[model samples]
Target: MANPWHALEGVQVSDLGEKYFLFKFFKEVDIHRVIIGSPWTFKNHLLILHRIHENEDPLSIPLVLADWWVQIHYLPPGFIKESMALLFGNFIGKFLDYAMKNLSNGYKNFMHIQVQIDVRKPLKKKKKIMLSESNLRKI
Candidate 1:
């Protein structure tokens, strides 16, 4: 995990037993960079991260939520508006933000949305929505 993170200085991972770990980073920037690159996994299991304060117990910190960037592809004609991203994002998970800046001007196949989801829950590959005009909205 540390190797893929590419921390500028270095990182130390402490095993806390029962699948929990305390990740210690030498550089503050490296830690922040790792956090910004959310939704990391190891051996197909989700690696949930929490920044605990000094003197806090690592095991006690909440670890139920994880942020993920979901790609919504081939949006229906009526569902392609920027404002609709919030609605679609919330439908998948807790809407965090719409990544409109990530999309190129020429790109039209999909949209990016950041959402916070429960790590315990299974992710859905496809979603269905209903539009007043179209009756069925699948993206």
Candidate 2:
């Protein structure tokens, strides 16, 4: 059986060095078939994917996926105030995993997902906060 995951080739990251990543999916035979996201697409897409899972909670759907990968870029301006890299990274990864499980067998939808973080300018001093498991208690 051929894998249905897509491969990304000739992919380019944004000039600003914004966090960018490539998600690849292959069929059982390992053939690349889709590439639908860029570093720029993460911000807009991340939240939507999150909600889908929240709304459908308690019921875990199994997505038949061949392979999935994410390339992350640094954060954008203003958004860099607080470092949520680790936090967001896991969030994004979880969402991608969920997405993989949700993709129906034989159904095609361009769902290459990415999460972008804002990186500060060079030679600049920024406040980096340490996020811990205890913080989740406050939420």
Candidate 3:
């Protein structure tokens, strides 16, 4: 039988420590498909995909301001920042691994990784009015 993980053979993996690994691909990969297909394989990893810039330090890779970004929620009382960082690192690693293996055909449109946070404000409460009174006035 062929190895199921064979596709990922070319991906470069780095240990970021704290259970975080960095997976880097040599070519651009479709982030949308990666995200859509991630849950099946990366159930335990938080997968974050970002474009790798040439000559730029990975630590300073500016966040892409696009529609696809990770949302950070208030952690339950005991969750620490270190834990969150590890989770994010794991995601980045897994995403790179998946992209390298699955997106090898060619680069697709909108292939860059973009990040944006969606903020939804609660709707204001509306005051109740008497419909009958309004109807009577109209009559």
TM-score of each: 0.80, 0.18, 0.30
RMSD in angstroms between candidate 1 and the native structure over all alpha carbons: 3.7
What ordering of candidates by lDDT runs from best to worst? 1, 3, 2
* lDDT: worst 10-residue window of model 3: 93-102
Clashes of 1: 0
Candidate lDDT scores, in order, read 0.80, 0.30, 0.36
lDDT by residue (2-81, candidate 3, tens digit) is 12223333456787655444555443443334434442225554344454556755555433222332333333323223
Tell how far residue 42 is off in model 3, in angstroms: 3.3
- Candidate 1 residues 1-139, lDDT tens each? 9999998878988999978998899899998999999778899888899998989998887799999888888776556656678887778789888764335556566778888988677877777765564454433
- Alpha-carbon RMSD to native, per candidate: 3.7, 17.8, 17.1
Q: By TM-score, how accurate is candidate 2?
A: 0.18
Over 63-123, each residue of candidate 2 has an lDDT whose tens digit, in order, gives 2121234433333322221234334444543323222112357532322333332322122
Best by lDDT, which number? 1
Q: Pick the candidate with the highest TM-score.
A: 1
Estimate candidate 2's RMSD in Å: 17.8
Q: By descending TM-score, how would the candidates be arranged?
A: 1, 3, 2
